[model samples]
Target chain A: MADWLSPAEWEAVRLSLRVAFWATLFTLPLGVFVAFALARWRFPGREALNILVHLPLIMPPVVTGYLLLLAFGARGPIGGFLDSAFGFTFAFRWTGAALASGVMAFPFMVRAVRLSIEAVDPRLEQAAATLGASRPWVFLTVTLPLILPGIIAGTVLAFAKGMGEFGATITFVSNIPGETRTIPLAIDLLLETPGGERAAARLAGLSILLAALALVLSEWVSRRVAARVGGR
Target chain B: MLEVSLRHAFAGFTLDAQFRAPPGVTVLFGRSGSGKTTIVNAVAGLLSPDEGRIASGDWVLLDTDRGVRLRPHRRRLGYIFQEGRLFPHLTVRQNLAYGTWFAPKGAPREDMGRVVEMLGIGPLLHRRPAALSGGEKQRVAIGRALLSAPRLILADEPLAALDEARKAEILPYFERLRDEVSVPILYVSHSASEVARLATTVVAIEGGRVIAQGPAAEVLGDPAILPAGAREAGAVLTARVAAHHDDGLTELDAGGIPLFLPRVALAPGSLLRVRIAAHDVILSRERPEGLSALNILPGRVQDVRPGDGPGAIVALDTAAGRVLARITRRSAEALGLRAGMDVHAVVKTVSVAAADIGTSGAG
Candidate 1:
């Protein structure tokens, strides 16, 4: 698959897949937890948390990236604490690109998960509780399995969004060939350079194909899991 | 005994009820919007009343005075919902074992094989809940609840969602649960036939208040507490399925008198509860010769309660059991019927709808 593309183009594709995979993997647990809290809990600041989580979706991607940079930049409080304490950083690094992609995709994942969680009949949870399953057990044994398809769909959406993330990634960790450049970032560079349109078009096509593949794979997986749980 | 005293007020309704139900099928019999479901939910710890005290014999589940309220899971009650809320994602086998899987370490688990056989759901073990019929779903729900090793079982009109045939199919399982299982059940129902068939203790509720509470026979035979008045009043009699004749007639011995009703699919000598509707009974001054009715129970009238309507309810101490006959006030006056009058109560064989017959809860 890499032989046909220029080394630079191939790197872009590889980097994008890695970033998206990491982004999706890291976003899932937090997304599910937040979605469940928003759907089923009645805590204070819930609406505020909801608005904050959704702000990225409504805000300009560059603005969200700027916000991320201020909080996670090398000299930033959280970044300085992390660098001094944990000795890790997300400033202009590949991790920063992944982090930007995750922030951009967080709301989409949460929305899908929250919708599915709300769709679950509370009576079923009540039934599980009456059958001697505590809250966490009810979630693990009933609610989680019931909402598997939704979680998968949300994951795939996040992954696809991650692959194409350009504005946030560029603003947070500027485009570098290997360090932070992904499919869209590489395509942007190729479009602007002298006689690089062909390579850019190829990369664009690759992004579309990858996204389509992710969607098809997620659909197939969701259907199979749904059938097991009798969701249909 | 399960003791409940709860008071909850809603926008336009209030529920203030108190009752002590002995260990059996204690049915909260009432019409819709009468707080039957609310009472059960309170007992199950699903709903917290404004103030209430609930105890299962020595185990105090909730007491607002002490600020003690156990969570629904910690209360260990099996609640069978009217809609059969089986886990849709689970196969029949998984749904049946779901409760038992979480049953506390020391809680006696109901045998999975026994539950599967009891509900006749072996063939459906691999199927999802969506594929089961309404009756089949309810049966599985019952199994799911029983296998939970619940300290108490709460059924909120478990059969209300089914059609007549489906209700009949599931009624026997509840009867078996009442008789065979040692756990007490708190059942809620608006149907008089279901209350008559299964309730060992009946608490009649109206407008969120328990108008009457006593043994099934006592509460069900009272016309005043009966929601539909005298029309819905019926007497429950314990009978033995004496024999099944070739002519599709099952002979049942109620007390010492033999009653020939439509054939019931029970082995001879099995316990059966026959609910004789008061309106279906005709009181005669003497045994009439060549009468076509299959049952002529000879008994003296205990008392006659005249209603504002032209109808009167005559309580009789027949050899079979305590039978009730609904005769017109004019008929009572014409026959000079009184407390000591000897009257033969005649019941037609076909008048007993098959739905009125149920398995006896004698245990």
Candidate 2:
């Protein structure tokens, strides 16, 4: 294990896991709300909302990072307000890295959850209302369970994307060691050092293993939920 | 009791309906796309009508004039849709329990065991809805509604999706619910046979209007009210089994008339309702001899209605009750039959098949 991961590499791996986990956790509930709105609700700016959600997917990663920095930088309006209200800072910090990763991975999460919400039968919701269940109760008991497989799929995909986020994280947080240096940042640093080809290879292998494990776990969880819910 | 008076226009069709339903099953009889479902949905609080007043007992469910529109859950009305609509994730027990969870705290608990036994769902409690047959799923759906302790039960063609055998299997359960449960029921159906067998009060709806409303027998027997007039028109008779004969016949005493039918397994003194189809009755100008038909009742022509096709509906009032006979125009012309004419109505004992007989009163 020591040969597989040096002390500095292990720290990077642990920090990357923490950032990915926090990013997925913070984005899931908002993702579900946005997905539901996109799937079921009709409004004046629905098309505009769809385009805005998909902008992160089409825009260059560095451009997205620059936009995030402009909006959430220390001197920016939102960043200044947040710092004053909560005594928090995002410029060149681990939290900034997490914010950038979450923004980059949000589109993937929203699309998966949106498709699942659309696939649910609306008639079932109407039936629940006729059975004396209110709208919220119907969603909790019927619609949520029916779309749980999709939620898990979206979560895993977002986590995997967060784990590999590089351009946005490095651009926003400036690759500070023992602070914002994630697995991708560490691998980049190793590639630039002298006689560091073997270290870069090791980090690359570790990233591949983590990504494969995330894929297998997602498949297993989604299949188990689908089987339990009696997939339509 | 239920009172609904409403008017609404949708797309190109206009719905103007008003009716009163007393205790027992009041059926909204009409064809498909005739606003039958719309009325029920309005009462269930799923659809808010433009101008309407709905009241059940003293509770005002909806009153546009008074600015009251109760939510669907607050209405406390149970609705059994065409499809069973069982929660896919819940087992039979869970589905039944889900209904009871929302019931008012002070409301009496409808016995879950009794509902299970009534619906014959005891063996299916642990099973998911996906594993049950269509008929079984419908039964569970009914049981779920009952456990909620609703003020009224609205069933929209509950048996429309089932096959003949499954329909036969579930019809008895609905009959029992109508008789045994104290709650009033509003049933919707287009099948004349189902209305004949189950309805206590029949509301004839055509073109989004209540054309006629009265007792099932009176409404179904009226030649002018029913579209089929004489050919498919029938009168519902409530009778009691008097005896079973060894010669393959069952004796029934309805009102004051002794009616004989083919062999049926009901014991003596058991109440039954029989639907005598109008086309099966042969009207004779007099009591003729050498007739092969076993049953003959002497009566007078109460009315005469000419049908659109080739037949004429003749209403005969016997000592028992009113009976309808469908006779062709040729026979009517040859016999010179008209209103107030005395006649003998002949019915073949074998024509009254066991399937046409219901074991409960008009409910």
- Lowest lDDT sum, 10 consecutive residues, model 2 chain B, at B227-236
Tens-place lDDT per residue, model 1, A1-232, is 5578988788888899999999999999999999999999999999999999999899999999898889999988898899999999899788999999999999999999999999999999999999989999999999999899999999999999899998888999999879899999988888899999988888888888898899899999998998888735
- Residue B6 error for model 2, in Å? 1.7
Model 2 lDDT per residue over B1-363, tens place: 799998989988899999999989999988888789999999998889999999976899999999999998888887888898888878889888877777878886679999999899999998888889999999998998888889999999999999988888888888898888988899998877788778889998888889899888889878778743344687777788999998988998877678899977789998888888888999899797999887787899988887778888888888767888888988998999888899998888888756578777442
Candidate 2's displacement at residue A38, Å, is 1.9
Going through the candidates in order, their DockQ values are: 0.66, 0.54
Q: Candidate 1 chain A, which ten residues in sequence have the lowest lDDT sum?
A: A223-232
Runs of candidate 1 with Cα error greater than 4 angstroms are B242-246, B286-290, B302-312, B327-342, B361-363
Which structure among the candidates has the greatest TM-score?
Answer: 2
Estimate the lDDT of model 2. Answer: 0.87
Tell me the tens digit of each residue's lDDT in model 2 across A1-232.
6767888889899899999999999889989999999999999999999999899899898998888888899988888899999989988988998998898889999999999999888877776776678889988988999899999999998999889999988887888998899999999998899988888898899999999999999999889888767723
Question: Per candidate, chain B TM-score?
Answer: 0.94, 0.95
Best-performing candidate as measured by DockQ: 1
lDDT (0-100) at residue B244 of candidate 1? 97
